[model samples]
Target: MKFDKPAGSNPIDRMRIVGQPRDRVDGPLKTTGQATYAYEHTEIANPAYGAVVGAAIAKGRIRAMDGAAAKAAPGVLAVVTALDVGALEKGDYNTAKLFGGDRVDHYHQAIAVVVAETFEQAQAAAALVKVDYAPEEGRFDLAKALETAKPAKDPNAAPADEVNGVGDFDRAFAAAPVTLDAQYTTPDQSHAMMEPFASIAAWEGDQLTLWTSTQMVDWWRSDLAKTLGVDKDKVRVISPYIGGGFGGKLFLRVDAVLAALAAKAAGRPVKVTLPRPLIANNTTHRPATRQRIRIGCERDGTITAIAHESGSGDQKDGGPEAAVSQTRLLYAGANRLTALRLAVLDLPEGNSMRAPGEAPGMMALEIAMDEMAEKLGMDPIAFRVKNDTQVDPEKPERRFSQRQLVRCLTEGAERFGWSQRNAMPGQVRDGRWLVGMGVAAAFRNHISLKSGARVILGRDGQVTVETDMTDIGTGSYTIIAQTAAEMMGVDLDAVTVRLGDSRFPVSAGSGGQFGAANSTSGVYAACVKLREAVAQRLGFNSAEAAFEGGQVSAGNRTVSLTKAAAAGELVGEDGIEYGDLDETYQLSTFGAHFVEVGVDRYTGVTRVRRMLAMCAAGRILNPKSARSQVIGAMTMGVGGALMEELAVDTRYGFFVNHDLAGYEVPVHADIPHQEVVFLDEADDKSNPMKAKGVGELGLCGVGAAVANAIYNATGVRVRDYPITLEKHLEQLPAVA
Candidate 1:
């Protein structure tokens, strides 16, 4: 089914199941610890354990490796090094090599894996394998590398110049009555997901089956085949359950590679789980970014010109952070410019995490917006409303399919009690605490991808849907069951969803916030085919047939849906493809974040008092799950604003806070009461589901809102992220 045009009145419009707030169907299993993760799978017989030996040097060549001690270690089966595998091809999705050969690209790059009878034995044996390295100086600092940064193209954009622009930005900015220019920096961040990278691999006569923790099963399967130099069909990847991803498990990591190699060497199944410290420096992270934003506006607060320039570092073939993407579309401006510069750095590979570009981009841009609002002596929400655009600012002919940013801000302001916030910073006080409220606009582009699913109608009246989509703790299982139940005219309990198996049809696979909408649409397409099949078997016109209450009705004739498949089980397989609708319509999700903070007058410490997010993503599938996703993102936003940082060790070219003990995230006590409100909306141009993603939208602009709130409370503007109290403590006003 090609979703080339706007969706009409479809079966999903019946609000019986799709829109209802439903509990996760997989919740019982997860809560009971019955659902098995990658390393916990017990189906394989007598599985060996593999422990990886990471390289100590960030950049250099391994002079020599001594595996004799490890080979002689008790319970040690085999010690496989990169040299044993010889020169191997890199995966298409991998920016840095998963396993280092003679050359080490980054710190903690896996150099060898020790297989043994038990995990402890493998770990102990891995430590016995000693290696000598010839270290070389590598680019470790983003600020120092920025001097040599070169203009890079946005991977998501069309083929064009390195810098994208419209009209004369310099001239307009110079002529504007009010202008603000500032630089902001966001430090490197870890996904810090609960589930570590883990995998269990088994081989039989050259065929390999891997039970792994990953977000994109098909992508990993294809990439693993390429990386292992094997036939794609011979490899199978399964991950039915995942603890958490946050974009960390979206690609093939070292765990899967090492597990496969160790299983081959040991002549048995092998399970590999990466150590906690290695997760930080061995895998992907959100790269640090230095962004300079210039906004030119009139006294009335109409944005006349805007330019956003961002610089970030990555591996040699890696792309920039794309921090300027949201700026090009957020507001209405005649003269605009957005540029991204990439610098080569020998840090862990930088890639997507949560909201990625917009999360960090808004951390800087929205704060700039607040600053500009102050310059105009206007309320920040009012200033944003004044500059709202119905059409794309860069491409005037393209109009937003559904834009409710103004509504989100207006409604969120009223709900959050914006009128009570004092315009003058440091004026309002609640005992020993200074109080302030801040708001920031949230924006994330809607993306649709080709997704397929297989639906089976059993004689027992149960509908089963199979797809390679992953849950990743985002309620994929429940939402998919809801879609299938709504489509098949059956109760939610009667539908079963099997996901994250390579044998199933390929789906969107949970990334870039596109999983929920696109994957469900695939299920809808398969159900449509099933409906047609049922109509044909019952001798009714498919177009006029209605499926309801487990019965197919046409005019005065009706028949039980079970009768259509009484002879045998009915099967349907289809996928949702797209045409130029996305190009013609600027599909995006909008939201507004309101945060109230109390700053310690004496200590300059910040505490969030309350938080609320008003989101306008099209047709939320399940309010319960959607709210969970939004609140989770809001919590991450708090972390980004006040706590999270990777603490780069520039001298050594590695992350210093490699473990959770040194790295800090928000605790339950640190978070305040959070409320999420979804504006009722459905984008016909998006897809058959008419739903857009809310997970990333909930995070976009949240960090900026928190930063703005801190500034409003203390009368101090700090452009750096993780706004530590020390950064503004000395500048705080003296205690009264």
Candidate 2:
């Protein structure tokens, strides 16, 4: 089914099951520990354990790696090295090669794997593998490498166009009455997700089956087939449950590939769970960014020219952080330009984290917005509201599908008690702590991908929905069931959702905040088809048929839906294909974040007193799950603002803080209070679901709000990220 036009008077508009604060359908299973994860699958039949051996040097050529001792060790089933893989093809999503090469790309790159009957034996035997490497000098510093950096024609999966602008920014900036130019830096960040990369692989004859924890099932299935030189149909991938991804599990990782190879060699299923330390360096991390933002505005706080330039380093062919993305559309400006430059470095692969581009982008851009507001002696919320654009600032003809940025700002300010905030820095005091409030606008683009689903209506009136969509701890199952129930006019308990299986119809997969909207839309399409089939079977007009009370009615004629399918199960398969609607309208999600913080006058320690986020996504499927996503993102924002740096070791070109102990994340004590509000809205241009993305928008610009609050409280402005007290301690004003 093509979603070429607005969804007009659809069954979903009834809102019988959707748009409710429903509990997660899989919640009980998760709580009871019955939900099986990748490494915990015991049905694979006598599984062996595989332990990875990572490269010791960051950039080097392996001289020799002796795995004979490991293979001959106790309980050892098999041992495989790069030599065993032998000239493998690289997956499209991969930047650095996964295995099968003598050259080491980065520190902790897997060099070999040891498989044994027990995990303990595999771990012990892995240590016996000895390796010699000839190290080479590698570039690890982003700041030092900026001089040689050139504009990237194509940065990873992003567009090749590096610079975009409408009017001349230089002339406007030179003639502006008020101008502010500042630079901000954000360090590399780790995902720090709960579950490490894990997979269990087994082979039967020429076919292979893998149970793995990943975000995109089809991508990994296709990539694994390509990497192993096998037919795509011969490989099956299943990821029914995932602990957490945060964009870390969006692609194929070492665990799945190595497990498959080891299982093939050991003649049994093999499970591989990457160590916490290995996950930090062996996989991907969010790249560090240095952003320069210049805003030219009138004394009345009207922005005229806005220019943003961001520089970041990654491995060759890796993408930049794209920290300039939100600046292009977030505000109203005539002369505007945004550019992203990527430099080649020897760091581990740089890719998506939570919010990716906008997360770090807003960290700098929103702070600049706050500083500009201070210069004009205006309230930050008012300043943002005054510059809100209903249409694209670059292309005035294209209007936003649904934008409530001003509403988000005004409503958030009112709820957060903006009137109580003192504009003067270091004036409001509580005992030995100085308190202040700050605000920042949030923006993330909405996208719709091709998603497919299959619905089966059993004779007993039980509806089964099958799709490859993954939950990733995002409440996909509940929302999907709600969609099916609303469309079929059945109770929520009558719907069964089967997800994360390769055999299921292809879905959008769970990444880029597109899963909920697109996947549910796919289910809506399939259910639409099923409704038509049932109406046809009952001798009723499909268009005029009303599905209610478990019956299909047209005028005076009514028939029980179960009676239509009493002979056998009826199957319906369809997908939502988008047309030119996205091109005609600028679709995006908007939000505003407010934060109040208290800073110790002497120690300069900052603690968040309260935080609130007002979001305007379209037609929230489940209010409970959406709120959970926003609050979780808000907590992650606190971590980005006050902590959560990868702590790079420049000399060794690797992340120094590789484990949770060395890396500091926020605890309950750090976040005193958090609140979230969702503005009621719907965008017909988005899809049949009328929904946009809210998960990433909650995190965007939140870090800058915290930073602004710290500045308002202490009179010390820190442009660097993870605003540790060490950065501003010397500059802090002494309390009276």
Candidate 3:
């Protein structure tokens, strides 16, 4: 179905199941430990284990490798090195070569894999394989490399100018009465997901099947085939359950490639799980960014001019962090400029994580907003409200499909008790603690992709939906079941959703928070076809037929839906395509984050008292699952604010804290309380589901809100991320 224009009153508007807060369909399996992950699959009997050996140096060429001891190790079946694979083609999605001869692009790049009877044996044998490297000096620091940084054009990014500008930003900024300029830094961040990268590969003749933990099923299948130089049709990728992704599992990692190679060398199936210590330097991470923001406003707190420039580093073919994306549209300004500069660095590949561009972008931009508000002597929320725009600031001819930023801020302020917040820093005190509240506007661009699904109507009146869409702990199965149930006129329990299989129809595949809306719309399209098929079999006009209560009604006559498929099961397959609606109208999600923090006056130890998020992201399919996603993102936002950083060892060009022991994340005790509120909205221009993504939106501005709160509490502002206590210790206000 081609979505050429805004959606009209469709079957989903019935709200029988789609809008209800339904429990996850896969909840029982996950909670009961019955959901099998990639490495836990037991279908293949007597599978061998593979342990990867990583290169010690970040950039170099392999002088020689000695695998004799590893070959003779007890229970060792085979030791396969990159030399054995020879020269191989890199996948299009991969920035660095996965496995090849000699060249080392980054630290912990897999050079060899040892296959053995048990995981312990493989790990022991992998340690026995020794290698000699010829190290070379490579660019390791973003600040040092910025002198040679250049504008980068990413194919995957939305079409925009390399240095986008509207009116004369320089003249407007110079003439403005009030202005603020600041520079902020966000450090490199690891995904630090629950499950590590793991895969199980088996071969049947020349065909290969891989059970892997990945977010995009089709992307992995096709990329694996490309990397192996084999027929794409011969490879199958399956991942029914995933512990968590957060954009870490969106690509084809080394585990899947190593498992496939080891299985081929050992003449049996092999399972490979990347060791936790090696994950930080071997896989992708959110790149560190240095952003400079300049805002000019009037005394009345209306923004007149704004400029955002960001610089980030990556490998040779990698793209920039895109930290200026949100600045181009978040506020209304006649003179605006946004630009991104990319530098080459010998660090781990930089890619998407959670909200990606906007996550770090807002971490800097919103803090600048707060600073500008202070310059104008106005409340932060009021300043944001005064600058809210219903159309894109860069392209005013194009209006936003649905914009509720003002509503989000107003509602969030009222609910969070904004009046109780003390505007004067170091004034509000509760015993030994200083209290303050902060607010930041949240924005994430809505993206839609082509997605397909197959729906089956059983003779017994049960409906089944199959797609390659992955859950990734986002409740894809439940929301999909809700969509199918609503469209088929059946109870939610009667519909089954099978996902994360290469053989299934290709879906949007769970990244950039686009999974829910586009994937469910694909299912809706397939269900529409099924409804038409049922109407034809029942001798009713398809246009006039209404499906409800497991019955089809037309012209005052109603018949059981089962009669249409009495002879056999009916099948329908379709996908949702787009024309120019997205181009004509700017689609985006808006939210507001309010955070309260208490800082110990003597020690500078900050504690989050409470948090709340007000979202206006179109119609929410399943409020239960959507709330879970939002709160989870809010937790990650807390981590980003307080203590999540991949400590870089610049001298060696690697992450020093490679293991969980050194890396810090937020624990349950760190988050005192969290509340999520979704506004009642349905965006017709978005899709038939009328739903936009909320997972990423929940995280966009949270870090800034927390940072602003800390500043408000202590009268000290730290522009750097993670807002560590050490950065503000000496500058904190004295306790009276």
Q: Which candidate leads the pack in lDDT?
A: 1
Candidate 3, after superposition: displacement of residue 7 in Å? 0.5
Model 1 misplacement above 4 A: none
CA RMSD of each candidate after superposition: 0.9, 1.2, 1.1
Candidate 2 backbone collisions, by pair? none
Runs of candidate 3 with Cα error greater than 4 angstroms are: 154-160, 733-736
Q: Regarding lDDT, does 2 or 3 come out ahead?
A: 3
Per-candidate TM equals 0.99, 0.99, 0.99
Write down the worst ten-residue block by lDDT for model 3. 152-161
Cand. 1 TM to true fold: 0.99
Pitting candidate 1 against candidate 2, the one with the higher lDDT is 1
- What root-mean-square deviation over C-alphas does model 2 reach? 1.2
In Å, residue 86's CA in model 3 sits off its true spot by 1.8
Query: Per-residue lDDT for 1-736 in model 2, tens only?
Result: 9999888878888888899999999999999999999899978789999999998989989888898899899999999998667767888776667888788889999989999999999999999999989999999999999878987542322345768788999999999999999999999999999889999999999899999999999999999999999999999999999999999999899999999999999999999999998999999999999999999999999999999999999998687887887888899999998888888999899999988899999999999999999999998888998999999887899999989999999988889999999898878899988898888999999888999999999999999999999999999999999999999888999999999999999999998889999999999999988988888888889999998778889999988889989988888899999998987898899999999999988888999999999999999999999999999999999999999999888898999999999988998888877899999998888999899888998899899999999989988899999999898877766642
